[model samples]
Target: MDFFTAQEQARRQTGRLVVLLVLAVLALIAVTTLVVAVVLYMAGIGGAHSQPQPTLQGMMALLSWELLASVAVGVVALVGLGGLFKRRQLRRGGKAVAEALGGREINLNTRDSDERRILNVVEEMAIASGTPVPSVYVLEEEGINAFAAGYQPGDAVIGMTRGAIRQLSRDELQGVVAHEFSHILHGDMRLNIRLVSLLHGILLIGLAGGMLLRSLRFRRMGGNKRDNSAALVMGLGAALMLIGYAGTFFGNLMKSAVSRQREYLADAAAVQYTRNPQGIGGALVKIGANAKGSALAAPQTAEFSHLLFSQGIKQGFSRFMATHPPLKTRIQRVMPGWDGQFVALKPAPGVTVEPDQSPQSTAGAGGRASVRDNVRASLENAGAPHAGSMATVLSAASVQMAIGAMGQPDQRHVAQAQTVLSALPAALKTAAHEPYTARALIYAMLLSENDAQRQHQLAVLENIALPDVFTELHTLMADVARLDVQLRLPLIELTLPALTSLTIEQAQHFRLCMERLIHSDGHVSLFEWTLYQLLLSHLSEHHGGAENLTLQACERECQRLLSVLAAAGLEQGLESVQERASEMAHALHAAQQVLPFELAAVEDADDMQALSLAVERLRRLKPLQKSLLLQSMARCIEHDGRIRPAEAELFRAIADMLGCPVPPLLGGGTEEQAVLAE
Candidate 1:
C-alpha cells in the first residue's frame, strides 16, 4: 500500500494488460486466418462443382479464382469489423466513463442520507489512499450484488444493489467495498473492461456477417434484379460472414484464459486488502448459503460475467465461464476451519454502527481491524526513514488483513462526514447559495493523507467556492486531526452551515491535485507532478471544466497510468490501496478532463512555429513545473486567463510532441472556471 508497491503493482498489472492486448490482436489475426481458410475452402468446392463441362485443369483454375476472391473479401471484412469494434468500445467506454463519474448518478439530487454515508466512506478511502473517488451508483434491484467498473482507476465506478445496502453489516459491507476496491487498484477493472471490448471486437465480425446472410438469402431467391457484381457480392458476403465467425471462438478462449488469472489474483488481493480472508470468504460463503448465491438473470449479465462479485449465472464446468474460483476453495485458503455455513454475527438493535473505540476495534471479534491498525502504525513509524515502497506490502496475514480492512475504515471517516452533515444549522438553509457551505462540504470530502497533502488540497480550494467560508472551515483541519480537539462529525460539519451556503463552483477545482501530491513530503518526489498540475490548470483555464477535449484528454492520461498500475495485484483487493488509488485516480481524472483539448491542440497545429509559440506561452503561465516545455506551454496561453480553440489546438500538438496521452478534462467539457455566480 505504500508508494513504491502501488507503482510496482501498477507496473505488473500494466504488463499483463499489454499481454492481453497482444493476445486480443493475435486472436483477431487468427480469426482472420480461419475465416479466409473457410471461405476459400467453401468457394473452391462451389467453383469445382459449377464447371460440369470443364476439364480437370480448367476446373482447378476456376476454383482457385473463386477461392481467391472469397478470401480477399473475407479478410477485408474481418479487419474492418475489428477496427469498428475497437472504435465502438472506445466510444461506448468513453461515454460510460463520463456518465459514470461526474454524471448525475453521483449528483446531489440522487443520493439519500444512507447512500451518502456509503459515498462518504468511498471518498474518505480515496482521500486516505490518494485516488480519485470512483463514482458510485445504486442498483434498485433487490439482489445482493456489487461491482466496480472502469477502463482504469481514474474512470472507475462502484455500484451497489439495494439488497446490499439493507442487508450486510457495516463491517461486512466494508469487506465488500474493500474487495471491489481491490479490483480497481490492482488493475483488474481495466483488464475486465478490456476483456469486454476485445471479445466484442472479435465476435462482431461473425455477428456482422451473420446479419448479412439474411440479405444474401433474398438475393439468391431472385428477389432483386441488379445483376452486376451479384456473384462477386454474394461470394464476398459469404466469405466475410464465415471469416467473422472463425475469429469469435478463438477470441472467447483467450478471454477466458486471461480473465481467470485476474480473478484469482483479485480473490487473493481481496483477502490481502481486507487482511481477513474470512470477510470476503465469509461473504462468498454467505452468498452460497443464501438463496441467491451470485445467481444473475439479466441478459446483459453474460456480457459482464467476469466483472461480477460472484457467478451471476451457472455455467458449464462451473470453472470455465465462471468468472470466480469455486467458493469452497476460496474459503479454504482464508479460513481453514470454515464450516461453509454463514456465521451469524448479528449486531444488537441500536448497534448498527461499530462501537466508537478504534483502538479496541483493532482487537474485537473481527480480526481485520487490529491487523490494519498494526500495518498503518508500522508504516507511520517507518515514516521519513522508510520511504513507502511495494516491498513494504508483505506478510501473508497482514497483507490479507490490510486488504480486507481497506474496504471499510474505522468508522471515523463516516462519523466525520456525518458530523459535517449534522452541523449545518437550520439557519444555513436560508443562505442556500453561500460559497462557504459548499467549500466546507468540499473539504469534508477532500481531507487528505498527510499534513502537506491536505494543505496543498486546501490551496487548490482557494477561490473555489465560498472562499471566505472555506477560509473559516480550513481552520478546522488543525482542530480535528492535527490537534485532536474534537472527535465528533457534528463539530466538523457544523463549521459553516448556520452561517453560509453550499454550492458547486465546478469540477475543475481539482486542477491543483498534482501539485498537492507532488508536494506531499514537503517536496516533489517526481518533477512530473508539477508539470501535471501546470497542464491541468492551463487547460482548465482555456477550456471550461466541461470541455470534451479536456475530459477525453484526462481519460487517455489515466488509461496510460492504468496501463502502468496493471502490474499490481496485491493480496488485498481495494482495501488499503484506497489511498493510492484515490490520489492517482483524482490526479488522472483531472488530466482526463482536459484530454479533448489536448488532442485537438496536438493534431491541428499547422506548423512547428505555431506549436512553439503556444508551447512557450503555456510555459510562462503561473506555477512553473520541472517540465520545461510544459511550463513553456502554460506561459504561452495564460496571458488573459483564456485559451481559444486555436490555442487549444496548439496545446494539443505540444502534448503529442511530448508523447503524453491527452486526459479528458475533469468536470465537463466547459472551459475551466466558469464565471457563474453563487
Candidate 2:
C-alpha cells in the first residue's frame, strides 16, 4: 500500500480500537455492578427490613436500577479520568515517552563511534524521506531492540538499546531505523500513543482493586459486629480484582490483534526502503541467536511491548497475546529463502565503520535510460515543448518522481541523499552538530544578498545573539554564502538535533534572534519565509493533534496556495509584462483542470504573510485530501516549461507543511550557485 492508504488504514484501526475499549468498559461496569449488588445484599444494606433469601431471584431483586446506575457511573468516571490523566502526562510527545522508558537523549556531538554511526544513518534516512530528523535516544540495556514514538513527525524520537547499536552492522542498523521510520510515515506512532493511554485506564481498575485490598490489612476486626463488614469488604475487593484482570486479559488480546500485522508491514517496508532484505533479516536472525534476544530490561516493557522492534517481553502461556510475530516467521517473510538458522552475534574488535559512499551510478545505466523515456513521455503528454527544452523535461520528471516517492523513498533517493551530505564542507558539518554554531549557521543562511541589508541583519544579530554565536556567524558567513541553494534545507535539517539540545530559555532567545534577522531588511524572501516556517513547525512547544479536514473546508486556503505557487512559477527575466501574465494564466488554468472547483486569482498572490496563513489552514487537510491538493500544486509548477530553484523550494515547503515528505530534486547548478561560486 502507498503512504496515504496506509495512513487511512491506521485511522480505521484506531476506530476499531475505540470500539473494543467501549466493549471492555461495558464488561467491567456489568461485573462491578453485580459485585456491588452482592456486597449490599450480604451486608443487609439493600433495605433495613429486608429478609435476605439464598436464591438467584433474591440477588436479581437486589440489583435495583438505582444501584446499577450508581455503580456504572463510578466505573465510567474512573476509567475516563485515568485515560485523560495519562494522555495529559504524555502531552510533551515522544520525548516524554522516551524519558519515561529510562532513555537518555544522545548528544549530537557524541564522540562514541556507535552513537555517531546510528546518528549518521538516521540523518541520511531523514533527508532521503524529506522528514525532519528525529531526536535519537539511547537505552543503556544489552537487548537488541528499538522503538519510534510520537504523535507526529514533528515531535518524533527514535530510541535504541546499547546492544542494538554495538552489535549491529551499519546495514543492520539502517534496516532497524528504516523500520521505525515506517511507523512514523504510516501514522502508527499516534495510534501507539493512544493505545498506551487507553490501556492505562483499563489497568487502573486492577490497581484500584489492589489498593483497596492492601488498605484492609491495617483494619482490626474486633467483634462479630465488625466481622460482617470485614467479610463484605474482602469479597468486594476480590470480585473487583477478578473483573479488572479479566478486562486486562481482553485488552491484551485487542492489542495483539492490532499490532501483529503492522510488524509484518513494517518489515516489508524496511526491505523496500533499503533494497536489502538481508539487512533486516539478519537483524532478526541475530535477535533469535542471542541469549538476551530483543528482551528489554526496563520494568515498563509490558506497557510498550507493541512499540518495540521485536518482542521486548515474554508472552505468558499464550501465543495469542504476543504483540509481535515469532522471530523465525519475521525473518522468513523478509528473506523467503531463509534456511531457518539463527546467526550468533560476536563482538566486533577494533572495527571502525564509515558512512557508505554514494554509488557511481544509481541502480544501473538501464535506470537512467528508463528515466529518459519517462521524461520524454511526460513532455509529450503535457504538449511538446521546444527542442532545446531538455531541462524542462528533466525537471518535470523530477517533480513527478518526488510526488511518487512520498513517504516511500527508494534506494535512488538514499544514494542522492548521500551525495548531498558528502558534498557539504567538513567544517560546516561539524558546526551543524554543535548547538552554539548551529544557530549561527542558520543566521548566516538568512543574510540578504544585498551588502547593506546583509550588514544590517548582521548588526541585529550581533546585539541579540550570544557574543560567541555572533562571532561564529562572522566566521561561517563566507562559507554559508558560497553554499549551494539546493543544500540549504538539508543543512537546516542537520541542525535540528543540536538545536533541540538547547534549554528552553536558550531556544526562545534563538527564535527571537532569527525573527529579527529575517525582517531586518523590511522584506521576507520566499526562502526566508520557507526556512522560518519549517523551523517554527518543528521546534514549536505544542504538537497539534490529528486533523480531519475535507477539501471543501479548506477551499480558500487551497486557492491561496495554488495562486502563490502559480505566481512563483513565472520567470523573473521574462522579456515583457504580457509574457509573465500569460505564464501565470497558464499555470492557473492547469491548476483549475486538476481541482474540482474554479480557482480565482488573488491580487496579493505572492504575499508571504497570507501564504503562511493559508499553509497553516491547509495543514489540517486529510491525507487523501492533501494528495489531491498537492497534485494541483504540481500541475501548476509543471504548467511552466521549466522549474526554477525558487519554485522547487516553494513546492517542497508546501509539501512539508502538508506532512508529505518529497525527496530533494537533485540536479544541475542554479544561478544562485553560480553567484555564490563567484
Candidate 3:
C-alpha cells in the first residue's frame, strides 16, 4: 500500500518491457534475413543469361554476412523509428490517448444527471486523495469499462463508456472509478502507453507489407520485365507482412504478461478504497451479464486494450492472450464464498444499498477518534520556541495516519471530502464548472485585501481579460471574498477541469492576465505563489520521460525546500529577531535529525523564486527519496507543534509538486475555530 513502493515496482516493470521488445525485434530480424536470403538465391537461379546457383553451397553463398547484417539494420531501423514516432505522438499525455480512441470530453457544465454524478464522484475522490481533478471523457459505446490515462497525476483523465454511466448504480460507478484511480496512483497509465507505442513498432512491418500489396493494383505488368519486378515486390511484401504479424503475436503475449496481474491488483485496490466489495464486484457481474460486456467497437481498441477496466476486445483462439482475467474468476476473488451468478441487466430503478455497520466501515465513516484532531492537539501541546517550552509534536499514530493517506486514502478521507464539497456555497461551486467563471473565480481569489492593491489588480484584469470574463469576475468577487479559507485549495482543485477546457487563445489570455495580477501587487504572497505554481504545472503540456535523481545529487534543492518550510512555520508575533532566528534553528534541527544528510545553512533570501526553482528540481528525485523528503518536511513544519493555515497550504503544495498527495490536515474543526487557531 506504500505509494512509493508501487511506483518503484512500475519502474522495474518498464525495464522488463524493454527486454521483451528487444527479444521481439531480434526475432523479427532473424526471420526477415532468412526470407531475404531465399528470395535472392531464387532470383539468381531464375536469371535468363546467368549461371544457375542451384547447389547448397551456392544458396549458402547468397546468405552472406553482409546480406544478413543489412537485413538486421533495416529491421532495427524500421521498428525503432516506428516506436519513436508513436511515442512522440502520445507526448501530449492521456488526453491524446483518449481523443485518439474517439472520446469526447464531457463538458463541465453539462446538465445530464449521469454526467453530473460522475463529475461529482471524480471531484470527491480527487480532493480526498489530494490530487488535481482529472478531466472526464465518455466514449460513445455501450460497454461497461473505464480507464485512467496520463503520464502523471497532473495530466490524468478518466474515460468511461456510455453503458457504464447508464447501467451501473451509484455505488457500482464509484467502484469502477476507484479502479481507474488505482491505475493512476500506481503508475500503470505510463506503462500502458509505452506498451502501445512498442506494439505499434512491432506491427509496422506488417503495415508496410500490406501497403505494398495494395499498390500492385495500380501498376501495369504486361511486359515480362515488369512482371518479374512485380512478382519480386509481391513476394517480399508478403514475407514482411507475415514476419511483422508474427512479431505482433509475441508482443501481445508480452502485453498479457505485464497487464493481467495488474488488473487483479486494481480490483483489490478498488475494494479496499471504497470499503465495499460489492461495489466493484457488482460492476464485474454487470459486465459479464450485459450483451456488449466490456468489448469496444472502436477500431483502435486493440492498441489500448490493456488500458481498459476489463478485456476491451473479444479474445480469439487463446485465452492466454487476454489482458484481463476471466470475469467469474475476478468476481470470486473480490467476493469469495458466493454462488457464481451473473447479475441480470434489468431496466429497473437503481438499487440503493444501505451503509454497512461493521466496525471498519464505521471508523472509515468518522465513528472513531479523528486523526486530524490528534495531530492538531499534539502540535498544540508542543508549544512554540518563544513560549519557553517545546515537546515532540508528532505522535506515532498521527504520523502514520498522515503519511498513510498518500495515494491510498481510505473511506474516511472520502467521507471528509464529501463533507467539504457539500459545505461550498452553491453559486461558487457552479461558477467553478464553466471556463469563463472558473477563470473569474481564480481572479477573485487573487484579489488583494488592501483597497489600493485590490483596485490595481482589478484595473489590470479589466484591461487585459476578455470582456465577459472581466464582468464575471466582478459578479463573483463578493462570494469569493466571503469563501472559507480552508475551502480555497479544494476550490482550486475543482477549477482544473474547467480551466483545462479553455481554448488555446483563451488559455494564453488567462495566463497573461494572471501574471499581470500577481505582479501588480509588487510581491507574491504564499497563497498566490502556491496557486500559480499548481495551476501552471497542471495546465502546461507535460512532455519527456521521468528523470532519475538520487537524494545525494539534489542536496542543494532539498536544503532550499526544507529551509522554505522552516521559514513558513515561524510564528508571526515573535517579540525579537533573535526569537525568530531561534525558532528557525530549532525547526531545521528537527528536520536534520530525520534526514540522512547534514543540513546546510540557508540564506535569508529564501524568496518564492528560489523555492519555486528548488521544488522543480526536487521533483525529479526517485520515488522513495521523495517519501523521505516529504517526511523531513513534515517534521520541520511540525517542530513547533502547531500548523498555521498558510503553513499547511504550503506543505500540501510542495507535496503535490513532488507527486505526493497529502490529505487535508484541517478537518473536524469549525470554520471559525480552524481560522482562529492559525
Find the candidate with the highest lDDT and give its number: 2
Error of 3 at 232 (Å): 1.7
**Least well predicted 10-residue stretch by lDDT in candidate 3:** 354-363
TM-score of each prediction: 0.53, 0.90, 0.89
| Number of the candidate with higher TM-score, 1 or 2 | 2
Return model 3's CA RMSD, one decimal.
6.3
- Write model 1 residue lDDT over 1-678, tens digit each, in one string: 422243245445556655665565555554444444443333444333333353545433433445555654654455446656654555434225333322234332223544644554454444323234455666554456677876544445677665565655444555677667767665566666766665665566666666666676566555454332345446645655665555555555555665666566656655543344555665666666566656655566666767767665676753564566777776777668887666543321222221111111222245545554454444334421321111122122221222233323223323222222222332331122233343343343345655676676667655454466566565544433332111122222222221111112333343343334344445432113323432333232121111012223233332332222221211234567576455434333333332333321132222323333333333222111212223333333332233333233233333422322221111111121111000
- lDDT of candidate 1 vs native? 0.43
What lDDT does the true structure give each of the candidates? 0.43, 0.79, 0.78
Ranking by lDDT: 2, 3, 1
Q: After superposition, how far is residue 225 of candidate 3 from its true place, in Å?
A: 6.2
lDDT of model 3 at position 129: 79
* Residue pairs with backbone overlap in model 3: 379-641
List RMSD in Å for every model shown.
16.1, 6.3, 6.3
Model 3 earns a TM-score of 0.89
